[model samples]
Target: MATLICEASGDWEKAKCVIKDCGSLKSVSDGSVSLDSSATTFGSTATVSCSVGYVPKAEKITCKESGVWEEAQCIIKDCGSLPSISDGSVRLDSTATTFGSTATVSCNIGYDPSVATIRCQASGAWDIAACTIKDCGTLPSISDGSMRLDSTTTTFGSTATVSCNIGYDPSVATIRCQASGAWDLAACTIKDCGTLPSISDGSVRLDSTTTTFGSTATVSCNVGYDPSVATIRCQASGAWDLAACTIKDCGTLPSISDGSVRLDSTTTTFGSTATVSCNVGYDPSVATIRCQASGAWDLAACTIKDCGTLPSISDGSMRLDSTTTTFGSTATVSYNVGYDPSVATIRCQASGAWDLAACTIKDCGTLPSISDGSVRLDSTTTTFGSTATVSCNVGYDPSVATIRCQASGAWDLAACTIKDCGTLPSISDGSVRLDSTTTTFGSTATVSCNVGYDPSVATIRCQASGAWDLAACTIKDCGTLPSISDGSMRLDSTTTTFGSTATVSCNVGYDPSVATIRCQASGAWDLAACTIKDCGTLPSISDGSVRLDSTTTTFGSTATVSCNVGYDPSVATIRCQASGAWD
Candidate 1:
C-alpha cells in the first residue's frame, strides 16, 4: 500500500479516506424512481430511472465530493404528440413523453383509425396510430329511376347523378355520399298527367292505359257531329296540349217551288229539321225535312192544290165559270125569284179555298107612312119575299093586312087609314060624353044618368066594324021604405023611384025622427027608421017631490009632485009631451 501511512504517526494508523454517499431519492408523481445501484456513496455512481410509464430527468447520479449526488428527479412521462390523422384527433392519458403513457386516436365521422390507442415507448417515443376516410357502400337502386356515379368508389362526398326511367320523374337530380357512410335518398316518382278534358258530344281515346307524360290521345265526334281536332299530346310538364272537338255543319237547304222552309235550330248542323210552308194554293209534299250527315238536307217538294166543289147556299144556287174545282176556278151566284146576289163572281184561291160569294133576299125600301098607323115586319131585314103587316093606331084603320117585297126591291102598295064609327046613339034618361071630336075606332063615349035614372053602362067604345056600341040608362028605383018599430010612412011617389021621398010618422005616443025619406041614386032610401020620442025627467019644484007614472020618461009618460012641509008646487001633476016638453 504505498500508503503514506509511514509518514503519519508511527502507530500504523487504519485511518483512510471514505467515499461520500447520497441518501434515498423522492418518488415521482404518477410514477416511481429507481437506481442502477443501491449505493449512495460519494464518488460512487448510480443510474436514475422512473417506474413503468415514467422516465428519469437524468441518466445517472454520481456521489460528489460534497457528499451530495447531482440533482435528479423522476416525473411523469409525456408522449410528445400523437401522429395526426387525416380526419381525426388524438388524446393522451397524460402530458408525458416518457414510457407508459397511452394516446387514443379518434377518427372524425365517416373516417376509420388504424389503431384506437398508442403507447409511449420506453425510449420516450409514442407508438404510431392513423385515421383514414371511411368508404360508403354502393348506392341502392332507385325505383322508377336510373343512377350514374361520378366515380366507381363510394366514399364520403362522392356524388351520383339520377334520372327517372320512362313514364317517371326524378325528384332528385343527384345524391351524395354522406359523412355517416350513407348515400342521400334518390326520390324517384312515377310521371303523371291528371285527367284529360272531355269532348262535348264527342269521345276521346287514349293510346295507353295511363295518362302519363308522352301519352297520345285521339279525339272523335259522335253521330251527327264533327271534330275540330283529331288528336292531342301529353306534354313533358305532365299536362296535355290544348285541343277541342266541335260539331259539323251542313250547308244551306235547297229552295222548293211555292214553298218556304224554316230551320228548327239556329245552326244548319246535322240532325236539324226544317219545316215547309206552302203558298196559298199550294200543298206541301212533306211537312219537314232533316239535315243529313252528307252536308245536305233531305228532298222536299210542293204541288198545286185542289179545292172541293162549292157549297150550296140557302134559297140560292151557285154556277161555275169552269167545271173544275181546282185552283184559279171561278163561279157565279144566283138567288131565287125574290132574292139578290151579294157578289157577281168568285174565284178559287191558291190555298185550296174559294173567294166568298153570297145569295141574299132582295131588300125593299121602307114602306110609305100612314096617317095614324104603323107597319110590322116578319123578318129582321127587308129582303126579297119578306112580308109586312099594316096596323092602325088607336083611332085609325089599316088599309092592308099584309104586303110583300117585290123582286125590284119595292114593297106592295099598302096604307093605314083612320077607323070610322057611326053617330053616337042616345041613351034613355041619360047623356053621353065623347072623348074626342072625331068618332074613330077606339073612340070612347061616357054615359051619365038623369036625376032619377042610373046608367046601365057607363061608357061605350067604337067597334072595328065602324059602329058605336049601344048603351042605355035605367031609372033609379028604391025598395020599400024601412019600417020603424012603431011608425008609418007616407010616400010622395007610389013607385019609390030615385028622387022620391016618403013621409015618416011615428005611431001613437011616438014622433017621426025625420019628416020625410028621400030615394038616392044608389037605389037606397036616404032615411033612418022612426025612433020613439023621449021626454026628460021633470024639473024640481020649489018645495016638492016628483013621482013618475012610468019607469021611463018617454012620450005620454006622466009625473006627480008632492009639496014639502011648507012648500007649494006650481003644478002637482006633470005629463011628458011628445015634443019632450012638460005639460
Candidate 2:
C-alpha cells in the first residue's frame, strides 16, 4: 500500500491535506476541490477544493510505502467572455472567465442597472439578467399652479419647472429627477399684502376689502371738512404707500372798516362763518362773511349814516347846537313872556329824520279871586301848564287845595269853590243850639231834650250842599211791668210812658211785699216794688194726718187729709188760694 501527503503552496495553503493521487485528476482555481479516493491509498487520501466564484482542478499524484509523495498538476475550469447590454455595460474580474467568477453590471448617466452583480456557472455562462435604463415616477402635482416639463416620461437627472396662475406664485423655481426613481415637487401659494393705513378726519374707499399688491384706495372727508390727500396705492412688499389725509384750513379773516367781526372759532376752517357788526352811528352793508371751500372768506363792509334838518317852532326863536344836522346833533327853542312852546329841545336821529314834533305857543289869562280863600301862583304872570295853590280862613276849608292853568288861556275853577254852612235845622222835642252865630262848613250844632224824653241823635251839622242835617228827639216809652204771682197791679195810664208809676197789691188774705213801681227812660220798667207776699204754713191735724200738695204753703197750693181706722174726718181737702191762705 502507498500513502500520499498533500501540502499547500502559494495562495492555496489553507487546503493542504494528505491524499492518494488519482491519475485522472485535473486543475483548480479559487473554487472547490475534490479527490477520487477509490483509486488512492487506503485510509490516507487528501484532496484540494476552491472557494466560491473560483474553479478548481486537483493534481494527480502517487504515494509510496516508504512515506514519500510524487508531485502532481492542478488546472482551473474556463468560462466564456461577458456579454454586452443595451444602454448598459458589464465588468468582469478577468478577460478570460473561469468557473465561480463574478461580473458586475452598471448603466450610463440618468440610467439605473437592473442587475448589480453576476457569477460564472459551470456550464461556461454568466448567471445574470440583462441591464435596463432607470425610471423616476411621474412628477408630483403642484397646488394653485402647474408644472412644465419636456416629456411625460420621467428619468434620472431630468428637470421640471413650477408656475402659478394669476394672483399666485410658486414656492420654488425648479425641481430635478433623482436616481431614487422619484421626482421632487415644489408647492405654489397665493400672494398677499398687509393691512391698509388709516387717514385722519377722513375715510378710505377701496375696490374690494382684500388688501393685495397693485390695489388702490380713494380718500374722502366729512361734510364740513376736506382731505389733504385724494388717493393712495398698495405696494408689492405687502405694505401700502405712504399717505397723509388731514382737514382743510382757511386763513385769518379780513378786517372791516367801522365794524367788528365775530368768528365761530379762533382758527379759520371750511364752512365757518364770520358775522360783521357796526359800532354806534354806523350800519353794515353785508350781514355775514362765510369761509368757503376755496379757503377764502365772503366780502363784507360797513357804512355811515346821516340825519335831515331840524323842525321849526311858532312864536319861539330856535338855535342849532351844531353846524350841520347830522346824527347825534341837538337844537333849542325859547318863547316870549306869557307864552310857552309845546317842545323845548330837538335832536337828530340816525334814520335821517328829526326827533322833535311840531311846536306851538299858548297864553294864560289873569288869576281869579276867592271869597273866603286866597290863591298864590308860581309866577305873577301865568302861562299854559302853570299851577296855583289856594287856602281858606282858620274856621273854613276849601273844596280843592290846588288849581292849574288850562290850554284855553284860562285857569281851571271847577275844583276852586269855597265851603259855607246854612242856618241850623229844628229838632222834635228838643232845642237846637249853636256855638257861634256864623254857621259855615264843618260847623256843629248841639241839642237838648225835654223832661221825660231822650234824644235820638246828640248833635247836628251843616253840609257843603248848603243844607242843615236835622236831628230828632224822641219821647221815651217803658216796656210792660213784670207779673207777680198772687198779686195785682194798676198803672196811672194805659201807655207805660217814662216817669209813670204803678201800684201793686197782693190777693185776699195776703200782705203786700212791695208798694209801687215806676218806668225808666231806657224803655224798661223799675222792678224794685213789684213782688208778692207768701202765705204761712197750713194748720196741723192730730187724729187724721194732713199731706200738703206743694212742699210749702205758697199761693195756689193745696193739702189733703185722711182719718185713721173708723174715725170721722174733720176735712177731706183744703186749698191754698191766691191770697196765701188755705181754705
Best by lDDT: 1
lDDT of 1 by residue, 446-490 (tens): 988887777777789988778888888788788877776787887
Error of 1 at 523 (Å): 6.6
Q: Per-residue lDDT tens digits of candidate 2, residues 75-105?
A: 5556676877787788886666887778888
Which whole-number lDDT from 0 to 100 does residue 213 have in model 2? 65
Whole-model lDDT values for every prediction: 0.77, 0.68
In angstroms, how far off is 527's CA in candidate 1? 7.6
Q: What TM-score would candidate 2 get against the native?
A: 0.30
- Model 1 local distance difference test score: 0.77
Q: How many backbone clashes does candidate 2 have?
A: 23
